[model samples]
Each structure stands twice: as structure tokens, then as C-alpha cells.
Target chain A: GQQVMQIPQYQHVQEGEDFTTYCNSSTTLSNIQWYKQRPGGHPVFLIQLVKSGEVKKQKRLTFQFGEAKKNSSLHITATQTTDVGTYFCAEGGSWGKLQFGAGTQVVVTP
Target chain B: GAGVSQTPSNKVTEKGKYVELRCDPISGHTALYWYRQSLGQGPEFLIYFQGTGAADDSGLPNDRFFAVRPEGSVSTLKIQRTERGDSAVYLCASRIQGASTGELFFGEGSRLTVL
Candidate 1:
């Protein structure tokens, strides 16, 4: 079975500090997707990386896919209260199914 | 049409009872999925439907859990003899196709509390 593991299960940082969460998968992934779930809300898609060594950014957020396509990371620059949420990395599978990582919960303190 | 929709935003039931949660995915979408998320955890895969039939259901934890998508647009997840451990948020998502680059559309999940 394929599994995606995320590091730093919980993180709390000062409002101005930077934060990063890492995700590793046991098997190669055809594509990897990132999602953010705000407190008391369902997961919302943020970005998707499909190519080896791919990198994409959305404002202060940066996402990277390892050259091997077996790992990914999400980096937030200058945390904000609005960034408080759980970040998940899902590996795309057949039939639109996504296997998710345990997730990293981010808490930003002002 | 706009986004995925789920009913009964919250549910609280006694142990050993049966429960059903509903999901209405985006119009025209061909793929739908169900997932469960415990407190502080990511969504765990439960089942996936391609059109009116289940394309993959290997993530189902046990026989007690079952789902159906007869019409291919809306779906339901049923649990029998539910346990206190069944308390969690059930999420539903839909996509245009199996291998599309577009992100999945998710609805506000159904939170189940087994007492």
C-alpha cells in the first residue's frame, strides 16, 4: 500500500516567522496536490504539482515537488492569522482518488 | 452546480445506531469520493465513484460502511452499528475526471458525533 507521511504534525509560530511542512510518499506519485483546511471547514485545494522538481507559488506560499516525485513541501513566508489551518498533501491515484497524508496543523500566533 | 454540497452539517447519534450522510457534487462532474477525518487529521479515503458505479472502494475500513451512487450525481454513505469511534467529519469531493489537473471541489463536511 502507498502512504504519504507529513512531518511536524503540529507547529506554532510567531506571526512574522516562516513555516514549512514536508510530505513524503512511500511510492512514486503521478501527481501531488496541496490543500488547506481552515478551522471548522472542509479541505480546500490550494495547488497541484505534476512535474519532477516542480515549483509553484501563490503569494507568500511556495510549493515544491521532489525530482523523484515521491515527496513535496509547502512553505509559508511570514505567517499570518489567516494562515492558521491544517495543511495536507494528497497523492493522486486512479479514478480521481487521492490518498492524503496525516497533515500538519499550523497555528500562527500574533 | 456551484460546488459540492452536503446535508445535515452535524449529527449526533447513540452507539449501535445506523446513520446516513448525503452528498451532492458539482453538476456535470463524473467522479465523486468520500473521506473521513478525525480531529486534527487529514481526510482518509473511503470510496470513489466513477459515474453510477464505485470505481474504487478499497479504503473502506470495514463491511459496516457502505456507499451508493445510483444516479451518478448524488451519493450517500451509510454506516451500521456505529460506534463511538465513528465520530468524525465525513467529507465529499468531486472532480471533472479521474486524472485531471484541476483541483477537487469539496463540500462542507458532515460531522458525526456518536454518543
Candidate 2:
């Protein structure tokens, strides 16, 4: 059984501040996917990291995969109200099953 | 539909009632997944359908829960003799076959509340 753990169950940041959420796994991961779920909304795909030590960026957000492929991180810079939501890291399982982390709930104050 | 579609966005029933939640995945997508999300928690895997047959249903909590994808298009999740713990947001997602590394397109989800 694979388990994904996320740190900072809740994050509160002021506008223009920077923050980071981490995801760790009990077992080595093949690929990690990031998703954002807004208030009252379903989870939406943000990005996916496959290669070890890979890093990808989406505007103000940065995603990184550890060299060991056991952990991942999402860093948001100059956070805005739009960044308020829960960020989840998921590990893909066989047959399209996903084991999702508990998530990092972010609340940005404007 | 352009994205996954779930019926009865919200449902409220008694603890002993039987409920069925339906999910219509994106057209032509060959993989479907069902997840349960409790308040303040991430989505928990429940079952997966590769086409007309279920490929993995190990995540199902008990025998009271069952799902079917008859035509490889739509799916139905049935919960018999539901309990208060059954209340949660049931999410449906779909992905194209052979794209196991691809992202999942999720529907709005069905919120179930048992009294």
C-alpha cells in the first residue's frame, strides 16, 4: 500500500507573500501529480512530475520532484487571493488509481 | 459531454437507505475512476474502470458498495444499507486509455449526506 503525506495541513499567507507545500511518500513514487481545489469546487489538475529531480513552473508556481523520487514540493510566489485553495499531491497507481495526499489548505488574505 | 458528469450533485438520505450515484465520463475516454472526499480531506480512491469492466476495485470499503460500467461509457455506484459514515463527496474522473500518466478530468461530484 502506497501512502502520500503532505505537510502544513493549513497555510495562511498575506498577499504578495511566498509559501511552499511539501509532499512525501512512504514508498518510492513513479510519478507525482499536483492538483488544486478551490472553495466549493472539484480538484483540478495542476501539473505532473515524472522524471527524478525534475522541476516545472506555471507562472507564479513552481513544482519540484526530489532526486530520490520520494517527495515533491509546490512553491507559490507572490501569492494572491486566487491562490487560496487546497493543494494535493497524488501518486498514480495501476489501472489509473490515484493515492492522494491529505492536501495543504492555503488561505491567502488580500 | 466535454467533462465528467455526475448526477444529483447533492443527496440527503436516511442511514438505512440505498443510493445510487451515476457518472458519465468524457466521451471516448476508456478509463474511469471513483473517489470519495470527506470535508477537509483529499479524494480517496474507490474504484476504477478500464472500459466495460472494473480493473481495480480494491479501494472499495465493503461489499455494500458496488459499481458497474455496462457499456464502457457510463458508470453507476450503488451503496446498499448506507450508514452515516457513507456521507461524503463522491467524485468521478476520466482519462483516455494508455495515457496512464495523463491528468484526470473530474466532475463536480455528488455530495451525499446520510441522516
- Please tell me which predicted candidate would have the highest lDDT against the true structure: 2
Candidate whose TM-score is highest: 2
DockQ values, each candidate: 0.81, 0.83
Tell me, by DockQ, which candidate is best.
2
lDDT of 2: 0.94
Over B5-93, each residue of candidate 2 has an lDDT whose tens digit, in order, gives 99989999999999999999999999999999999889999999988999899889999999999999999999999999999999999
Stretches > 4 Å off in candidate 2: none
Chain B: TM-scores of all predictions: 0.96, 0.97
Residue pairs clashing, model 2: none
Candidate 2's DockQ is 0.83
**What ranges in model 1 sit over 4 Å off?**
none
Q: For residues B37-95, could you state the per-residue lDDT of candidate 1 as single tens digits?
A: 98877888899998999989998989999999999999999999999999999999998
Please give the distance, in angstroms, between residue B17's alpha carbon in candidate 1 and its true position after superposition.
1.3
- Candidate 1 lDDT over residue span A20-94, tens digit each: 999998778899999999998889999999999999999999999999999999999999999999999999877
